[model samples]
Target: MDIIGFLKSQFLCHLFISYVFIGTGLIINLIQLFTLPLWPLNKQLYRKINCRLAYCVSSQLVMLLEWWSGTDCTLYTDLTNYSKYGKENAIVILNHNFEIDFLCGWNFCERFGLLGSSKVLAKKELSYVPVIGWMWYFLEIVFCKRKWEEDRKTVVQGLQNLRDYPEHFWFLIHCEGTRFTEKKHEISMQVAEAKGLPKLKYHLLPRTKGFAVTVQSLRNVSKKFYTEGRRSMSAVYDSTLNFRNNENPTLLGVLNGKKYHADLYVRRIPLEEIPEDDQECAQWLHKLYQEKDSFQEEYYKTGTYPGTAIVPARRPWTLLNWLFWASLLSYPLCKGLANMISSGSYLTLTVFALLMVIVSVGVRRMIGVTEIDRGSTYGNNENKKKQP
Candidate 1:
């Protein structure tokens, strides 16, 4: 492993990186707040400025994943229609299986020149995550509480706001609502059985209200890109990272936040074909997840997935972005923080520390939930004796 990669693997290195990102993010957010007065006078200009600011912040992490860590991302897709990617607005349906899946999605966005504008229908909790969540707010990214009744109206309204966006965009949606887990999978399979639907070995039950509402809202305004559906979307699927030695591999790599061998299968489905009724849409989504499960099973056994040719991830813009942010914001932000600390503002320091503590606790809780123990420990001898 290289020196940068080695540093990334250490706990101290992760802590340092986290603190720097958090601190830098806090400063950027403060800068954003100062721009609030300008919004009422120039809404469009404010949005455009916000997008540029966000690009500066997020591109750092993307650079860390791509360049510093030397992670390889290969996309599988047909070249015939690749030119149509960012020319039109579309809804992107993706599987929520990995921690850094969003980052990979962003990487694709970067490649297609849509990094600044790509959005997602994320859970409400993510909106509080420092740089990423704050940036999403200005990008018009939709956040859902995940309750169908409560989320339906708000999500649709959010999607509607994107109709007149100045630039082309891709709205990503993880229909599963949360990341995949074995226990969740089992429960979802039970729900499927009760509903008389086929069981899925790879994914959990998809909460279709979000997808249904999104389709309804954007059907007239934009096109649709179903990553795992029939016809190909102009995007490509990059080869992700996977660890073979660990019993349960930590998703985070040294330089890369987390390693995932992502094989995205993108297809462009027309907006009109998406079911109209909620119940029908939900049923269709359930069947789709079942098919995704079968594909995953085939992949695990055969070590390959059915898809088109691979495309290399060559995002030079990511490097340029990192350099720009570090040059423009790094020194000024550091000086500002130093001055504040030296001024002896007790209350401000207390508030900052408290917020950091809360964010740390929340991140820990999320990681814990995603890492629930699922393996069995008892030997089969006892079971065999009891059966006899």
Candidate 2:
């Protein structure tokens, strides 16, 4: 291995990285806590402050995918609406496939200047997790319990709350509701069959009620008050992502500095173009997924989606933000390591070895969290449970 690859493979380097990420994440979360008071005083200023703080936290993961692993994420998009990518509010639809799909999503958000303010309709259980989850609460990321009866009100209120959000953010949605697996796909198609829906070859049936609610809340807003001038329009970023050579990527692969090239095909659709009525909206969403399946089929055959492909300019902010954290957090960690070594003490060295083993296990658990096998059982038997 070369010097860089050898360094990346070192236990000490991984330790330093994990320490910096978790350490700075906790620190930023603490700072986010102080913004609660600012929320009541000046909500917009509070939002702006939280945006930058959230950037400091989320960009680290983006750094892992883009900078450390050196993965290339290319965008295939309409050149006409390309300039407006980072300038407007959008509801982004993404495929839930690979373990590192969200990391790739974060990579695009970083490039588009939306990393700090990107939102997602994540599961409510994630709200309790440390670091990213806690930081997301301040960013106003919408969370759901996956029950239509309970989540309808929560999801509606969440999307409605973003009416006058200060930053141009992307509210990302994975309508499939969980990462794809052969078993999940098997059951998902059974549900699709029960509903008299066509079988999908590439994706599971999309959950539509939350999407319908999101559209009504953000789509038809009456002339709203100004946040960078009052044009009440929200667009849909219909995005389909796939990897080159059909590579199944994982967070572990990324952490170990393995690179994967990703291609994301996006089409910008105006919310006005979609039906406003809930039932109609749901139908529109299902049809959109059908089209998305076709896109995936094309990608599988041609290794490209149908589009005028263009790569957006990569910004240096992710790298810079990571460097800033590493510089700040590494000093104390390295100094202690140096002192421990120079002392020539077995006890301290033994303790360090044990700590490495513990961290290795912790890292494995973290990677396991992103594995497809560990994904939620939301739709695996929903149709059967509803039946006799």
- Most lDDT-accurate candidate: 2
**Model 1 error, position 275 (Å):** 2.5
In each prediction, how many residue pairs overlap at the backbone (N, C-alpha, C within less than 3 A)? 11, 0
Judged by whole-model lDDT over C-alpha atoms, candidate 2 comes out at: 0.85
Under the 3 Å rule for N, CA and C atoms, how many clashes does model 1 have?
11
TM values, all candidates: 0.76, 0.94
For 269-366, candidate 2 gives per-residue lDDT tens digits of 98889997878888888899899999999899989987787766778888888899989987977887998889979998998788778677767777
Cα lDDT for residue 7, model 2?
A: 80
Assess each prediction's global lDDT (C-alpha) against the native: 0.63, 0.85
Q: Least lDDT summed over 10 consecutive residues: which range in candidate 2? A: 223-232
Q: What is the number of residue pairs that collide in model 2? A: 0
Clashing pairs in 2: none
